[model samples]
Target chain A: MKLSREEVVHIAALARMSMSEAEIEKAREQLAVILENFEILKEVDTTNVPPTAQSINLQSVMREDIPGESLPAEKVLANAPDREGDLFKLRPVLE
Target chain B: MTDKYTDLTIHSAHELLKAKKLSSVELTRYYLDRIGKIDQAVRAVVTVTGDLALRQAEKADKLIAGGKDGPLTGVPVLIKDNMCIDGIRTTCSSKMLENFIPPYNATVVEKLNNAGAVIVGKANMDEFAMGSSTENSAFFTTHNPWDLSRVPGGSSGGSAAGVAACEAVYALGSDTGGSIRQPAGFCSVTGLKPTYGRVSRYGLVAFASSLDQIGPLTKDVLDSALVMNVISGQDPKDSTSVPETVPDFTKGLNGDLKGMKIGIPKEYFVEGMQPEVDAAVKEAIRKLEELGAKVEWGVSLPHTRHALAVYYIIAPSEASANLARYDGSKYGFSYQDTNNMWEGMEKTKQLGFGPEVKRRIMLGTYALSSGYYDAYYLKAQKVRTLIRREFNQAFEKYDALVTPTSPTIPFKIGEKADNPLQMYLSDICTLPVNIAGIPAISIPAGFAKNLPIGMQVIGKPFAEETIFKISYAYQQVTDWHKKTPKL
Candidate 1:
């Protein structure tokens, strides 16, 4: 399907990406070509075929819930772009 | 010794170390000097861990002195930047993770450390391994060592270029869809993409989890096997990892392919492929027959034409979900301080991700979005099953399938950068293997004009030994793997 400017804006919003009008225009054109290329898959007949999400044949593996090793809170928060005294600093989530 | 150490493979270098003729520090220094002098032109290395590598080399020397040795001990290797290294900056060649140093090592990094492999540096890649050329890297592009004017295929371009330039003995590269093999092909080196669950993905910044697998790009097929022996295994950290027993992959490098039923897929020899690439691969198949392997044509993979389409949809869909974690809240780059959280995230993503990455994320988000998921994403997944089934049935009649790793030799740097569809086509030959979660290797087949052509030997799932055996045999009679680019 050919993507419109409005659809591109909605996708960027869902992807948390902000784009300029020029970037959106470029994206709309490129994405339209890519999606059109995807039209080839529509030719295949997969009447009863189940969608394959995982490649290997395996069930959800359950491991022991006991904690073996955990990163310290300071270490866990080490790479945070913004941090408070002991918590991640974020823009106001609650008014 | 210093001059010779730079081109030595892991096995040959290990032999020297074990024979007490060389020290790991000397080998490390040799490679470091080469990288320092030549990597400027190649632009393959993102960050050179000189001090850490020297430190590791010193420790490896001590281990060798104590008579404790392994194949990779003291062998200098490059790590693709996406794999997290403790205290070392693990940028995915993007401004987003430019300074993001992980406090922990990836499981593969830990495994390499245990094997005593000297981690020389991190190699550049396409940002988030999204594009087919390193031009997508937010930092800089890695030029092909064969000819500086051409591109080293990516997103593992840096790894392949580094090895091709003799900057390191071998390097680890991830293959989501031909990332490792395509670059290896373009750079004229040996690269293997193991089965999906053959190697652990813990700490490999996920691109497409179902298709992503880490493998080696080496100077030769033996080095590929030597490195694979160290990296391939099940890890409790990666739940999708198969519980199959890990074998010594190097054990199959006996230069034997007698009675091996190798199939030459007719679908892979499609039109528009460079005639030389087609001829080189066909000649390589004849050479395999000379070694007593039955090379048959007419092995049909009807779904080959649609593998590329299925891959773009499925890979980006997974990438969209995986990359959502890159919000400004937790780590990496952030923007618009003192503003609302939503604005900060939007601005950060807009600024942090490169154009190709943003393109993929947008593509993925649209495919997975409501009202389109079933038509695009779900339909793609169903075609994915047909692609996988074709491989399964083909493998029933053949031990491995041989094809040209790429449709053409390496092109000019900016040749396909503007056309995203053309760039995606760079991976046409190698995508089906990843889609089917099977093992495949790209070995230097022969030269087309001045550049190298890579021939792929693809095997069944978890059958790396089969491909390795065939690749080793092919490399034995052929000297293409011995030819190095004069940088």
Candidate 2:
């Protein structure tokens, strides 16, 4: 199952990665090789088999919801590449 | 001067520190100097926190003086870059997190700090632990210490190589598939992947949440047990952390495997595997039998061949979701050469992630895409159940399973770089252990030429004691774990 260039580009878009034309060309071949590896799974009979999301069995562990100290905003924003005072700065979503 | 302490394990370092034979600062300096002098060739360490290590060493000296020393006190450790260390650069070897400094320490880091372990450096890895070799690191690839031309099996390559090169007493590595064990095998160190949820993942950078597990790569089986004793515990911060009481893994280190039952999975011995790996593991099995353990061969894991396919689907799907948080808006690198938030996110990730990471993200995006979710992702999860069941059935009759840690010895750099599938195949033997969520360890079994071949010992869920028992017995019968690479 080879991925067409358009399909690879569309998948990249959905993944929030912008690929250059060159990268799209490269992705076409690499993604095809990988997807072909997955094609072997179609031969397996998984009918009636239950899905395993987690290897270990555990219910959602809940704690008492109470107010506690959060990380200081300054510390949380320390790694932000673009930030205003106490706020993360981002490009406008819509023009 | 030859740094004699460089070859000391964490256990011996702690003993000497307690005896005042070696000061923590002096020991820490020895490692820092070794890394500075030798790491240029191996490229194992990404960031050397010398000042921080000295400060921590001073604290450890105080603890030892005050008779408050813990098991890891004064022992220098290299942490995989993906794990957070408060105020330290935890890059995950990705450009996106290149400048990321976590405000809080990961649970394991905090535990190590409390034990007075010295933080030496952050080791290089496959970018976000996505690849089988450290060649995927955006900054640089780590080379095997044994042969500088060859690649260090990776994601945990730096951690394993660091220990092998005597740059660190021990190191922590996370295994999503074979990241820890494969590297340990290639670099000729001992590594353990605790049962899934056995170690807290609170501060680890998420890769594939379900498959990701933190483990120790040490110079020997005993050091692995010693580190495991300190790191394995439940944490409230990680919801997936198991509540089972962590055992003293060292208690099972009597090296007695009398009457123990070990199964050898026939499926793991495929054609095209290195003849050396097959022979070394078989010899290790003979050694196990000589050590009084009953070795059973020809056990079949029928679904073992499907593990690579299932792992590619499940891991990427989870990684795609987990990595979505890396968009430029909040933390990490942001590309400003865009008009809007969406483009900013796209452009930042496009430039930030390496080629292998992008491939995985795209693969995951496609697998979990609207029309293909059921066909790919869901089906893979169901098959994951089948894979897990196979191990369960094997464990019913055997105390543990043994196999080669990797299919081949360390290959030359760029040998498998262009072929991603070939790189992925290096993990074929190790992936089934993770999918089964059982504890497994890779210990140096013997040498193939000069490179090391690793044998994996796998145990049932949360059965680390059993795995340790088998590994320790094997180590006792052989000196492979003691043969450090002459750098």
Candidate 3:
């Protein structure tokens, strides 16, 4: 399982991260070693096994859909890096 | 006070508080003084909430005076930075949120507060709980209290070291793979990872949601049980939290494990495991046998080899989804780029998160992406199921499974920093329990070359009572849990 540089770039882009060429190369090698080690699972017979999403065998524990006190708008925006009157401002998404 | 304070467990501390021998303020101050002196070299604490802790201690003293003292009344505890504490800086040891203060408390934090426990401070962790060693923490690396140069097994290294140093009576830590247990092993503390969903994840900064669980790092099994009792209950805020009644976990502490069936998995004893660790674990098992527990060798978790791989894929996949909310918009660092919002997001994440965190996010994004979902993410899920079924079969014949909590002892800080694969292997033995969502505990087994080794005792789902019984019984017979680092 060889992870190509291009694949690394694609992964980084999807993850919202930027990587240098050197880091991409290093990631390619490391990811390949991990992927190769994982190949051992190929020999195990999982035909009858059901995928376990969570460790506890539990069903949904839903809460009543009720209204709750909302944080003040100023409090919500207090931590934002950039904001505009209850709206978070960002660099323009589309040209 | 030094003699009384040196080895005081939460149980004893509460007893003293009730008898007026020790005030909550005095206890909190004692710990703060200890942290001030010892934490300089170890760097275990990232933020010390001295004022808030003292305020809570005063409140607890008032409660004790009013005859409302609880089991953990006036006990001071450290929380891993990843768990949100309202109005306190919850950094997760990353530069990204270095200045961020959570507006609300995490469920576990709220529970501890309600139980009369004082929040002493926030402990350091790998940035966003992403690394095996605290070196990855952007703030500072926490050194093992046993050997200042060696790494405290992480990303719960701070919690483990805090308990080891007696800086806090007990601390709360989250374990995704080996975060709590490995650090506990290294620091010679008792740490447990309750069955997944046992502790609510309402205010936890999600690492790998499915694999992550909040548990206690304590000076001994009894204190672990004390903290677990307060925190292990369902919360309406977290959808994944189980609604089952949390039993009085301390109730079975004195229950004899005389005829209990203990399983020793052959797979965990595989080659490459440190010989000293192997000997320590075996000695602990022999002691359990001497204490009247029956030991049986059994096959377990044939797919155990795939745990690390599957964990890397699944954990990061969930992490990617969870961390997506940390865009420049909501909280944390944001890049100023007039070009475009997506470009700004890319720049913010790239600049904010450390290399290992970014690497995982990338791996997870790739695995969960449109074209690769079936080949990687879904396939890993199937393997995870197989792993759980294997444990179910083993538990049918055995009451508990025993293994070395960590395959090897703690490594030097920089030894495995560059090798991501080497770092991932640290979690190998501990990952299976999380994958199966079963209760598991790491107790101080014995020392290997002066460093601590931990023995893991894993029990069935919602069987924390069994874990407590086994651990408490073992602690009674052996003094491993009593030894402290001569820092």
Candidate 4:
């Protein structure tokens, strides 16, 4: 049930988290214990059971396509860590 | 003991306000003073909106003067930090949003404001509501009001502690897995997780969309019901919030349980639970029977054993997706030292989240990864269906189910903090109710070893009134809830 170091780094990357060597090892050990416990679900007979993504039935929530008041540009940009004229300023997308 | 404003329940305060015996301003100031003096030890309150509360209290007084006051008018209430209030910092007890302020108020906040509730700032919580103990908070661990050395149970620990210490008249808490009820039990206060979709999630920060719910931690069940009446209803903002009618939750507190059916599922009283926890909940169930409930013991929910696995998988999967919004460019903490945007995003996520948060994200990513989807995520969902069905079938024969809110009394701060599985096991008794999307309430059943034990009363979906009825009747006959921590 032990998770390999490479597997831990792989999943952390997929989760958009950068981990140091120590963090990777700690996460690997902890996740191995947690994921090992997930083995319990295999005992349940879910042969014919359909997956339930939602407990209550869902329907398309429709709203009129009419224009309505929305948050002002200043308000939306207020929390931006770095912004340039109502747009979030991120570093170059490509190196 | 001195008679103080902090000791008043919402109902009693409402009466005083209506009769002009207690001014809203006076009441708000008294609570502010108490929190100012006491919250330092408990660490329950994160932000104290003394000015905003005073302003809101003044407005509420105006409404009362004009004969426009409702039950919650002028009531000082604390919100779990995850819920947004315009111009206030909504941290979710995470460093990612340490300075993040919301542009708008959450739907429940708006509802409370509309009902003239005085906003008393925010309460602490586990980081992103991830862990069972508030020790996961990046800021500081919220100490249990009853015993300062132990944890307050979380991620609603601060909310429960606030009410237990009489800091707020009542406080709002959010539950995904036993977050609200567990802490409520630990603090010896009343807590309720309304049916999923019963209350809107519009402005509340999302943790796990399907499992997360907004509820109240109050001094008593009647106060919880009073708050629910104001906050429960349909909201057009959150699509998941069902279009259902909200009942006057306080109307069912007639102390009547005659002919109502209650089920005691043996699966909940598991091995290794504290013997006193089992005994206290058993005594509460006997009280239910005495109140004329047709109590049926030895009931079985065979699929109950697998709930923890299903919940860990499903909740984290939803959380990984829900939390992807915090990439640092738009809002929340951002890491900008790197020239490459992707590197910046990754570093921001790495530094912003705590260890528990990172662990969940990793678990989620692995479960949804390409080759493993069907084995972990999909299989968990299928088992979720079985667990939900088991509860659905049990409800067909019973109006409610009774169980201990937590498996043991509140543990020391670091007892299970590092061991993730042991912390997860603490919530075993209360997890299935969330997986099934039903309503449940935890009330003060008794004290063991000088610590409080909570008995969970669970009801069918949208059957909060039945839950209130059962717990309220028990409260009538028992004096356990009447005993608050002498902080």
Candidate 5:
């Protein structure tokens, strides 16, 4: 259950977050205790259990295939942190 | 600035409004002014919608004048900050969404507006609904109304505190692993987490998607039902919202619990539970039996022990995926100083998210990572099926299950904040309900030293009416719901 500092950094990158050296140490300590708690689940026998899916026990719902009123581009971009006209301005993905 | 309308439930308020004894604007102002006067100390509200409330109230008065009003018409209510309010910022108590004003209303907001309920303001919560206390809110911690020193159990802390303080008639809260019920228990208000699909999730800021559901927090059980009547229904916008018949939640509330079978899950009453809370819950069970429900004690849901493990895994895994959208360029906060998008995204997340949120995302990333998936995420899902099956079997023999809503009464504000595991343990009693995706209601059962203890009434999937009926019946014989904090 204990994660190494490198492992914590890797997980942070996977989550699209960066951690300082201090945060990595903090995360390692907290996540180790939490992950160790996961050991309790190992005691439960689930030899033939099927995982619950996104579509739950309730009936699968489908709406009519038709167009409906939608938010305008301007409205949708109202909260954009970096915007140009209706488009969101962004840093280049490639340097 | 105090008025006669303070602490009025929706039912009484509706009666006065119907009799024209009070106008909607007056009632709205009463709440708005009260919130204005006392909210500084309570710290429950994130943003007070005084201007919008007045405008909505003015229109509601016209509806009442024309005799076209509904139960919730002109009733002022607070919404948990996670739910979208068009033009009003939906911060989710996270800096990431600190300035994010959704363009469209969440389905519940639309329903409330349609029912003529005046939006009073947004309530504070744990950032991204990640913690059991409002200490995690980037804005400020919402204090318990009963005692300013105690923590209001959270992520719906603000909503519960607001209702308990009479800041609003009722409020909406989203529950994922006890977010709604635990706080309701702490604050001595009634809160309900409906069947996962009973209420629409569209426009609600996603937490653990499968485990998350929006419900009501109110001064009484019936107020929860009144708000439920307005908010519950199938929405085409959210595919998970089920196509179930919406019942008039207020009807049959006074009906006796005769012949109804109630189960007491032994797993819920664990060691280390506060003596007062334990005694109060057991006493509440006796009260239910006195009301004619057959109580079956020692009913075992054996898989309950693994629920906390399963929840941490499943909830965070889903949240990790759900929260990936906060990339900074489109909406919400973005770190703009980076030369590259990758660094920009990373810096945005590192700076935008709070500790608990970051911890969850990392935990989820690790659980779902290639080598660990089977050992963590997949295994948790399989165990989730077992946990749910245990509830399914119990429901076959009982109409509902009764349990303590929280292990302890509201603790000191800084008591568990530093210890993450202890804070997480605050939700142990309430997590299994969200795991099983069933309906559960927490109502004030009793009190200890001026703080309230809540008892949870859990029901089968899509069985909101059954739980509501049981809760309302319990409320009839008890006056716990009648007690309010003398803040």
Candidate 6:
């Protein structure tokens, strides 16, 4: 259950977050404590239990096909920190 | 009139509205004035929608005058910022979304409005509902109205504090873990986390989808029931919303609970629990016994020790997936590029999300990644099932289970901030209900060292009516819910 510094770095990269060396060290220690505490699950017998993903046992409820009034383009873009004409602009992602 | 409205319960307010003694506009303005005067020091509301609320109040007043007054007509309600209110800024208390005004109303918001409730303002929360304390909010930490130096419990701290402070009649808060109940406990209010899928999650900015549920934080159990009646229903917009009939929640508030079997699990009285919290919970249990309910010490839920671990894994795993939609291009904050799309997402999310949020996303991504799903995510789900089965079996004999809502009383603001594991333990007793998808409520049980403590009443799935009945009965007998935090 021990989480290594490399594992923290790997998890951070997978999650698409940039972290500093200090954060990695802090995460490693914190994650280890959490993982160790989680080890108590090993004592429980879960052989016959079916995993419950949701509390309500209901299937998808779909709405009928219908058109509705949509917000104006300006209204939609009102909160954008950076935007172009009808589109949200962002920093380039490719190398 | 000011004091009358200030201390009035939702039931009393509804009566006043029907009798034409109080106009919705006046009630809304009263709250707005209160917020304007007191919130500068309390810091509960992130953004006050006074003008929009007045417009809604006018509409409610017209409805009341026209004899179409609903149960919640003229009731001014504060909503957590994470719940979407179309055209109102739904910041989730994060800098990235500080300016974001949702384009559409969340299903709950629409339902509340349709029920003739007026929106007071958006209350602050832990940024995207991440932390146990309001300190995580990027805007400002909402102070405990009772003790300004202490926190009011969090994620939904502002909602709980606002209701506690009488800034609003009732407030809606989403509980992912203990966000709703913990804050309610700290502020001495009634807060419920409905059965999963009971309330629509369409416009609630995703935190942990499976564990998240929107419910009410109110002054009393009756108001909680009334608010629950308005908000609980199926919606086609949310795929997971159940199509079951919304029960008349208030009808069963006076239902008899005599001879009901209440279970007290031994696991909840774990080591490290504050002596004050333990004493307060015991006192509440004794009161329940005095009300003619049969109490028994239950031995079920042996896997309770693993709840926090299981919750951390599963909640963060779902959170990672749910938060993936906020990549800056579609909504909220986006950084300007010197590179390409991948760099853009990295820069935006990196700069936008707080440290705790980033930590969870990373943990979740690892758990759900190709190789680790079985070991982490899938294993956690299996453990979750075991936990649910424990409750199911226990409920077959017990009418409801009782436990302390939190192990310790509300800690100082920065006490557990640096230690994530210590912070996670705050939800130990509360997380089982969320993981099991049962209806649970926290009511002010008593006080410890001048701070309020809460006792959690957990019931089987779809048993909110019974839970409320028990809670109402308890509130009627005890004055714990009436003990207000003096600001």
Interface RMSD for candidates 1 onward, in order: 0.9, 1.0, 1.6, 0.9, 1.4, 2.1
DockQ of 2: 0.84
- Residues B10-85 of candidate 4 have per-residue lDDT tens digits of 9999999999998999999889988888888999988899999999999999999999999999999999999999
Give TM-scores of chain A for all candidates. 0.89, 0.87, 0.84, 0.90, 0.84, 0.86
| lDDT per residue as tens, model 5, B400-463 | 9999998999999899887888988889999999888899999999999989899999999888
Off by over 4 Å in 5: A58-61, B1-3
* Model 5: TM-score, first chain: 0.84
B231-309 in candidate 3: lDDT tens per residue?
9888888878888898888888883789899999988886789999999999889988887889986556667888887
List-wise, what DockQ does each model earn?
0.86, 0.84, 0.71, 0.86, 0.76, 0.59
TM-score of each: 0.98, 0.99, 0.97, 0.99, 0.98, 0.95
Q: Model 5 chain A: which ten-residue window has the lowest total lDDT?
A: A53-62
Clashes of each: 0, 0, 0, 0, 0, 9
Which residue segments of model 3 deviate by more than 4 Å?
A: B1-4
lDDT of 2 at B226: 89
How far residue B444's Cα lies from its native spot in candidate 1, in Å, is 0.3
Clash number for candidate 4: 0
Looking at model 1 chain B, which ten-residue stretch has the lowest summed lDDT? B1-10
Candidate 3 chain B, which ten residues in sequence have the lowest lDDT sum? B1-10
TM-score of 6: 0.95
- Candidate 2 error regions (>4 Å): none
List candidate 4 segments past 4 Å from native: B1-3
Alpha-carbon local distance difference test for all models: 0.91, 0.91, 0.88, 0.91, 0.90, 0.85
